[model samples]
Target: MAEEKNSIHEELIDETVATETVEGEAVEASEIEGEETISLEEQLKIAEAQTKELEAKLEEAENRYYRIQADYENSRRRARLDLEASEKYRAQSLISNLLPAMDNFERALQMEVDGEQAASILQGMEMVYRGLLEALKNEGAEQIEAVGKEFDPNFHQAVMQVDVEGFDSNHVVEEFQKGYILKDRVIRPAMVKVNQ
Candidate 1:
């Protein structure tokens, strides 16, 4: 009887240990599943943060690209306009230099002549003056008429203001030096006497 009681007690203790072991294993499995879910959530959060950072970087890069494109376009437009303006005013410097020579020629042709030889020389000078004037005309240069016209500061410089007979007030009486214009730009203003 004692041995049988001992066997029954040993069986009960073994069954209780087995039941405790099973419950411990079930608790450990649940803890492991919860840990895995937390780890997945953390990984997803990290991935989303990284994605946002990359999107911001992409937008910044695109904005920089657009700004550089606009700068290039503006630079190209400025260069083209500079080229056109250079072409438009190509002959201005040369014409400016030749104006003094033309003035000297006109002075020479104004001298009094005494003989046939002097008259022939004067005729030759006149022909040359006409040719030079024609060339200037072809190049878009023109003489501004100053005599018997209204004296304007835009085209004439009044060196002397005087009372004159049969002339309107604020009109030009006499032009001492001629003025010239290249296109719409005045090269020199005419030196003139204005009637008051």
Candidate 2:
């Protein structure tokens, strides 16, 4: 009877030891799972932060690109305008120089003819004057009409005021010097006598 009691006591001690070992292993596994979960959360947070930083950089780059494109378009437009302006006024200097020669031609044609030779010379002068006027017209130079028209300060310069039977008030009675326009811009104003 004592031997049976000792055997039962040994069996109880072994069972206790096995149960403790299983409990210890379960606790260790739970600790490992907790550490893995924490690590995954930290990794996820780091990845999200990096994504936000990259998105900010991309937006900044896009903004800079749009600004540069706008600047380029403005510059291109300005350059085109400058080129057009230069082209429009290209013949200004030559036309200005030729004005005196044109005046001389008109003076020559206005003289009286006393003989056949003088009449022939006048005819030749008229032809030359017509040719010069046609050439000037082709180059976008045009004469401003002054005589018999209302006096305008933009195109006509009043040299004197005159009382005339046929002319109305503020009308140009006579044009002393012809005005010229080049491409919608006035090169010279006509010298005129305005009727009061």
Candidate 3:
């Protein structure tokens, strides 16, 4: 009977040790699972940060693209306006070159002729002057009326001021050189004497 009791006591000790080992293994497994959950949360946080960074870069790139597009539009508009202005004044230089020749013609026409040959030459010159005037008129150019008109600085340049009979104050008394208008723009202002 004593030997049987000893054997029963040893068996109970062994069973208790086995239960402790199993419980320890379960605790270790739970710890491993908790670590895995924490690592997953950390991974999610890192991914969120990277996504936000990429979004910021994308917004910056979009803003840069918009700015470049606006600049290109403005440059194109400016170039178009410049081209239009150039077209509007295409004949300016040619008209400017003809003014000195017109002045010479006027001076020659004023000379007195004393003989038949001289008078015939003068008649031919007058015809040429008329033809020149007609040609200028056809090109949208016209002489500014300065003599006996109001002295406007836009069309007349006052070179001399005088008190003249039969003329109002601030009126053009005599034109030294004729002014001309090419289209709507003034090519030259008339050099004139103004009445005081």
Candidate 4:
């Protein structure tokens, strides 16, 4: 009987120890789960902050790239304009130098021719002058009309004023030296007599 009782008591003590160990294990597992949840939340917050910072940096880089592209396009446009201007006025100096020679030719043609030979020579000179004028015209050189027109300081230079009965006041009476225009710009102004 004593032996049976002692076995029963030992069995109860074993059961109690097993229950306490199981409860301890359950509490430790719950604590570990709570820690994991807190760690996951912190990681998510850190990742969100990094994403926002990267997005901001990307936006700034894009803005800088667009500005550089716009600046390049403007510089290219300016260079093209400069090149066009230079090409348009390339022959200005040569045309200016030829003006005196053209004046001399005009003076030679104005002289009187008495004989048949003189007239023939004058006709040949006139033909040459006509050819020169045509060539200049083809190269975008144009003559400014002065006589019988309103006098304008932009195109006509008045060296003298005259009182002519037939002409109106402030009108050009005579052109002494011819003016020329190249393209849309005036190369030389006409020397003229203005009516008072």
Best by lDDT: 2
Tell me how many clashing residue pairs each candidate has: 0, 0, 0, 0
* lDDT winner between candidates 2 and 4: 2
Poorly placed runs, candidate 3 (over 4 Å): 1-66
Candidate 2 Cα outliers beyond 4 Å, as residue runs: 1-64
The residue-by-residue lDDT of candidate 2 on 136-189, one tens digit each, is 898899999999999999999999998999888999999999899998889999
lDDT for each residue of candidate 3 in 67-86, tens digit (9 for 90 to 100): 99999999999999999877
- Measured against the true structure, the TM-scores of the candidates, in listed sequence, are 0.65, 0.66, 0.65, 0.66
Tens-digit lDDT track for model 4 on 16-125? 33322354553333234343323434544655566568778999999999999999999999999999988997777878888898888899999998999999999999
* lDDT, model 4: 0.81
Considering TM-score, which of the candidate structures 2 and 4 is the better prediction for this target? 2
* Tens digits of lDDT, candidate 1, 81-145: 99987776677788889889889889999899999999999999999999999988988889999
Candidate 4's TM-score: 0.66
Off by over 4 Å in 1: 1-67
RMSD of each: 18.1, 17.8, 18.2, 17.8
Q: All models: lDDT?
A: 0.81, 0.82, 0.81, 0.81
Candidate 1 vs candidate 2, TM-score winner: 2
